[model samples]
Structures are given as C-alpha cells and as structure tokens.
Target: MSELRRFLEQLTAAPSAEALWDLHCSKMAEYGFDRIIYGFSHYMSETSMGDPEDFILLTNHDPSYMELFIGNGLYRDAPMVRWALHNVGACSWRFLWDEMARGALTEREKQIIAINQRHNVTAGYSISFKAITSRSKGAIALTAREGMTQAEADEIWAEHGSDIVLMNNVAHLKIVTLPHQSTGRSLTKRQREALEWVGDGKTTQDIAMLMGLTSATVEKHLRLARESLSVETTAQAVLKAAFQNQMFIVDGIQG
Candidate 1:
C-alpha cells in the first residue's frame, strides 16, 4: 500500500520503454535530478559496445547536447561513465572534481567537464548497476537541475542515495521486460519461444517436447528465427534475441 510500491506497479505495467522513461524522468525531477541518460548494452565486451543499433539508450537532455555527446564520441571521455564502467553503485561527481584537482584527468575528461558546466549539467551522480555478465553493462547519469551546486547535490545524495539507487535499479529491472522494436527486426511468438528454449540450452528435441511439436517444426522455427534476427546460426539468433530483449517476454504464448 506504500506509494513506492504503487509507482513500481505502474512502471512494470508500462507497455513501452518510452512510457516508462517519461515516468522515470518525472520521478527523478522530484528529487532534484532534472536530466538523465540511461544506457544498456547486452552484447558489449572489452573490444566494442557491439552494434550501435543494439544499445538501449534513453535520455531527457536537450537534443543538441545528446547530438554532440554521442555523435561526437564525447561519452568515451566522460569521467562518470569511465568510473561506472569500472565500479558499481552510486558516486557523486565530486570525485571527478577531485580527480581534476589532483591533476589526474586527461585532457578529454577535462573538456567534458567544461562542456557539462557550460550546459548547466554541473552537478549530479552516476550509478552503475552490477554487471550481470562480462558481456553486459548498464548505467545512468543523473544531472541536477540548474542552480544546484556540487555541495548541495552531494548533500542530497548523502541523505537519499540509497533511495535513488533503488529506484534506478527497479527501472532497469522493468526495462528488460518491455519489447524493443526496431527496423526490419521482429520475432514471431513461436520464434521467440524457440529462441528462449535455445538460450536455456535446450536442443531441438527438448524444445519440441516442451512445445508439443515435432522436432522438424521446432527446427523450422529456429531457422525462421535466425532469418528474422539476421543471424547465421541458432546460437547467434538466441544471442541476438536476448541482446534485443526479445526473448522470454511475458505472454509470448502462441495462438
């Protein structure tokens, strides 16, 4: 009966990522963070962020700012992002300033700091969720509204850091359940179930038994899944489906 539980119920009911993100932005705004960028990569490794198209990046910053930050590769040099990549949990931006004070930041990181300052994104914290796998990373950058000082933002975090972290964590957990739709990529009900079973390490015979179908029908579904996902093999199809957050979706039941 708590307000937080009701909000979470609404969040989990949001049928689309866009709808959920709007709710998130509003909630964070109530807590002094007026801007946020949340990005998730399910297929990243040390070598690459994987395909640019597979990333689930949601933000409420000005279009021009995002255009420059992502289009110009400024995120590569963002100190908060770097910190999140290496560590988990929330931390205030004071650490970035501390790094700057100690003369440890690279020129690129300093430039990003200046950009953030100019754009009224001068104070906030970054919370990086624990990596569920070596190949996945998800994090959020929350920027305090204009006029809030670093000290004030730090004070807010000191008082409410655990609450903020819990909310963002719930947001991420709800996000992976919503379907991701993209150009020329979608899976049928059967295709999704087949891929889910494969990702669960089931063979064609196992999937057929579970789905009450012949092995040949399961193989057909797997082949179609591979074609729909633009992958070459069943394994690749399963990985691609998971990366796109398409497998194990609720109500994936076939008609």
Candidate 2:
C-alpha cells in the first residue's frame, strides 16, 4: 500500500482520539501541502461521535508569509472559506479562481488573491466536510507553488482522499476532549439508535413508526436524550451528542 493508504489504515486502528489526531498531523505533513487548517463549531463537548472544536492548522510557508496571513486576517476573507461554506466536497484552486471570477468579490478579496499570487501560492486544493456538531463546518486545504497544473491538483485529491477524511475525523475527536465530564451514563442501545435517526433529520412520528413504537414513546426517548446530554432541546441534544462523539449517525459514517 502507498504511504497515504498505510496512514489511513493506522488511523482506523487508533485506539483513542488523541492518537488519531497525531496520526493525521504526521500524515498530512508527509503529503507536501504548504498549509492545512481544520476548524469546528462549539457543539462537540462530551459524547463519542466527534469533536467540533478540535482543529489542526499546519503550514509549510515561510515565516514571513505566515506572519502576513495572521497580520491581515487573510483567513477571515479567504477563498477557501467561501469554498467550504458553499461546496461540500473536493476542488482545486484553478476552479476556485474561475468560480470567484464569476462572482461578486469585494476589493479586500481581490487584494488577498493578489497577495497570494505574488507569493507564488498560485494553486490549491481542498476537501470540505460538514461538521456533525453545531451548524459549523470545515475543510482541509493544500496549496502549491505557481504554475502548478490542474492535473497535479486532481492527482493530489485522488491520492489523498482517505487521508483528508481521516484528518477530519481525528479533528472531531479532539473537539470532544475538552475538560468536562469524562465519563457519564453510557447511552442505551435504543438511545443510540434513536439519536442516529434524529441526526438523519427524522421526525419523531417517523422514528416511532420505523421503530414500531408509539409517538409518545419516541418523545420519551428523545426526552431522555435531552436530559442525558444536559441540553434544553432535542436539537441541542443531537448536536451535542454528535460533537462529543457520543452518537454516530449511520448515514454520516465514512469508509
């Protein structure tokens, strides 16, 4: 297997969230991207589903370029941020620029692009993923030197899809490691099943019918979910469960 494949296999075998994050960072450095950043919202707190705040921000750029990025808050108006908000999958810099050209861009955005070009950061690729916690999301971006071609971008995406997914998963794990309740009452099998259904956007009535329970019974289970997660509403319960890695939605599981 290729190194990327081996790394992914290792990630699959990782026994803890910390181990997974370390593996992801090491493998990402091996992929030769100039920079990578993963961010999550405030949802992941205590469960076993994934971490929302845990992120890995890596860069191989010169110290000066890094300094410039932070000094100007370029990340605030970055094209990658736009791409992550609008696109849910993988894409490249050329395509990103092409899309930007077709959209209305502020002078600040244009200036950021100009700065990137001046620094020879002419090409980039990103694979964005939806955050299971909160309403926030994130992506992993890889940038290349000037004159890089679309073929190279595609090659990187094809070669590194699994690594990108693994990185995101580990990031989720880290978000759940915040100092708080480390151990709580374990979720019952039925609670776990119901939580997964809720995460998939199922209505209580629908879940009741699917599980062959009364709608009131469904509500009772959801009430338990809310109390167990210490959240006020079902939505908060679902989001909290997701962020804390307490519940894994069947549909959201990636290979």
Question: Which ten-residue region of model 1 has the weakest summed lDDT?
Answer: 246-255
RMSD of 2: 10.3
Candidates in order have lDDT scores of: 0.85, 0.62
Off by over 4 Å in 2: 1-5, 12-26, 29-34, 43-63, 145-147, 158-255
Residues 148-215 of candidate 1 have per-residue lDDT tens digits of 98899988888878878988998998776677743346898898988888888898899999999999
TM per prediction: 0.80, 0.51
For residues 74-163, could you state the per-residue lDDT of candidate 2 as single tens digits?
866777666676667767777656766788677787888899788877676776776554545656666654566666756776787566
For model 2 the TM-score comes to 0.51
Give the deviation of candidate 1 from the true structure as CA RMSD.
3.9
Which candidate has the top score in TM-score?
Answer: 1
